[model samples]
Target: MRSFVRVAERGSLSSVAREYGVGQSTITRHVAELEQALGVTLLNRTTRRITLTAEGARYLDDTRTILRLVDEAADGVRSATDRLTGTVRISCTAALGVRHVADILFAFQDRHPGVCVDFRLSDVQIDLVREGVDVAIRLGALSDSSMQRKQIGASRRILVASKEYLDRHGRPDEPGALARHAIIRMSNVSGSDRLVLHRANAEPSILPVGDRLLVDHGLAARRAIMMGRGIAPTHLWLVNDLLEAGIVEQVLPDYSPEPVPLSILFVPGRARVKRVRALIDALHGALRALPGMT
Candidate 1:
């Protein structure tokens, strides 16, 4: 089954055989046996490529589910021993990974030294299966419903400015008033030049904002704001220390951007892996313990 699945995915019998450290004949025999037992042609082979039959496509889905279930069952049995040993590949946004997740992963590894962690930090979403990523930490809404996910926490988006900037330009009492003030825009946060502000029991307002400085990274935006560039909306956790120290103050306190959700996402089939589960648990615990998270 594994060999057949590999062949279907790779579309090359010789490549699959080489990967398994076996002769091409061995893989051919395995596929032949499977087709004979099922009484169906699974693949159409040509000198150039291999294409799956309709039945083969359907059977491939079933095979993947069966294989995943078997792996999950085996993981469950191994997890009973309370020891995890394996490499876990994880993906996460760059800023969050460096500022938050990396520390948690370090602590998790300290606790379970047998487990190795491979971290891929980037701003873009990656294909979990194709990239062999065991798990991903994502912020905001998730569009992929097929993956398994757990909401770890919520990130409140608050508009803030350095105390010096606010004192110099005067704070905006309403969302619309922000149009007149300089704005440090985080381009990655919203694709538009406008900022959307929400208020309790009121219609959301879209305010035109200035683009004195535009940045693609959250940390860069935060730094610009700290240097008194302009007012901008940011995750509360990212500037909690500055807020506490009175270096920055919230603007238009009555209005806020919609809270973004923080979630741990993984392919459904691999969610039950012992190492993946351990990392997920650690993430949940760590994120919940952060300031401003309930």
Candidate 2:
């Protein structure tokens, strides 16, 4: 059943065999035996690839549910007296993973030494189910409505630049003066041309920024700002350490871009697994402890 699930998801018998440290013939025999017992064609095999039959697709769902339930039942009983032991696969944005999330996972592992953490970092959002990720720490808005998620916190974003850059080019006291200075824009964010800033006891400011440098990654933009490239809006967690070290200063202390939400999204029934649940609980608190998160 485990082999079938891997074969269905990966669509390669040899790949599954390699992962399990077994021969291709062994994997083939396992699938053949399962097919013979079930009395159904589970997959269509060709030279190039294997595709699942309709029956196979339905069976895959049931298999996943059964596997999850079995793990939950076993782990639940063992966790009462024994140490929890399993792998918790997690996905997180690259910057946050480096700046904050990685430490959280490390601390979690310290507490549950028997548990293993599989951490993956990517700027691009990945399909949690296809990637076999138990949970994903997402920034900004979430698009998948079908997935179960918990709102962890929000990261405060602010306009910032290096002290040297501010000294070279005069600081903008008002939103209108920004047009005179170079703007470092994140190309990945939607509507990079316009910036909306909010302040207490004042109407929100909507300003159009002319980009002097464009970067997609948070660390890349941080590098640009530190080199005195230009002023850019960035998450406080991304540069909080630098800010404290006097490497960079907030461009406009009074105004800031809207705080981006931090969320933990998990695959259905994954939270029932003891290790995954433990990690999720640890993340909920640790993520909120980040400098800008609230």
Candidate 3:
């Protein structure tokens, strides 16, 4: 049915075959089987093109509606089931995946061995539908309002540097002084060229930042800071361990960037899947347990 729908919509058997990653003969056979089952000619084929017969035109609309309802029914059944069992495709930033999400996934897998997880860790934002991702863990503000979101916790970005770097370069006394210090910039996020600092009951301060080093991954930026390359703004959770161990210290402690919201995003109907719902619940609980997460 999916193949037929694709063929009808695209108006080419070969195109549908490529979309499905199957041979053209397979798509031809699928349509042939459907026609045979229905005992009616659904499409008129010429040497160069295929056109839907009148019967095919009417059937196509009904088929699309049927397919939609079928999917909804399956989702409903999955949502009501007690046992969660299926593959869940998830995407998250590389730093968060390495530092935190991996452990949460392991624990969830341990509890529900029947569930399989396809985890893709990258800094680039992925299209949930196009990428077939069931869930995405996003940090900071969400731009796509189409996806359903559940705020799990909050993450604050703060200026941090290695003790060695601080001792040598000296800490900035205020937001304005940051211009004199070398800055490690995260290339993946927006506003890397500027620092916006906020404090309680005070107007926000903005200062242009110089990029001494730029990295694509948060972990890479953190490494640059720890190597005494420069000071960088980072999520508090990412550097919490290093802070406790006296490896790195927060700079300009009096001011911090506005806290970025941490959220789990999914397609509208995806939350109805049992496996997705289970994972979301597990992740929410895990994130709440982390230090400095609200």
Best by lDDT: 2
Which candidate number would show the highest TM-score if scored against the true structure?
Answer: 2
Residue 291 local lDDT, model 1: 61
- What are the lDDT scores of the predictions, listed in order? 0.84, 0.89, 0.84
Q: Residue-wise lDDT of candidate 2 within 118-165, one digit each (tens)?
A: 899998999887667899999989999878999988888999999999
lDDT (tens digit, per residue) of candidate 1 on 37-150? 999999999999998999999999899889777766767777778777777889998877877889999999999988989899988887776455779999878998878998
Runs in model 1 deviating more than 4 A are 1-81
Better of 2 and 3 by TM-score: 2
- Output the worst ten-in-a-row residue range by lDDT, candidate 2: 125-134
User: Candidate 3: where are CA atoms >4 Å away?
Assistant: 1-82
Ranking 1 against 3 by lDDT, winner: 1
Candidate 2 Cα deviation (angstroms), residue 167: 1.3
Q: What are the TM-scores, per candidate, against the unseen true structure?
A: 0.75, 0.92, 0.77
Residue range 189-221, candidate 3, lDDT tens digits: 788778888998999998887756888988888
Candidate 3 C-alpha error for residue 100, in Å: 0.5
The segments of candidate 2 whose C-alpha lies over 4 angstroms from its true place after superposition are 10-30, 47-49
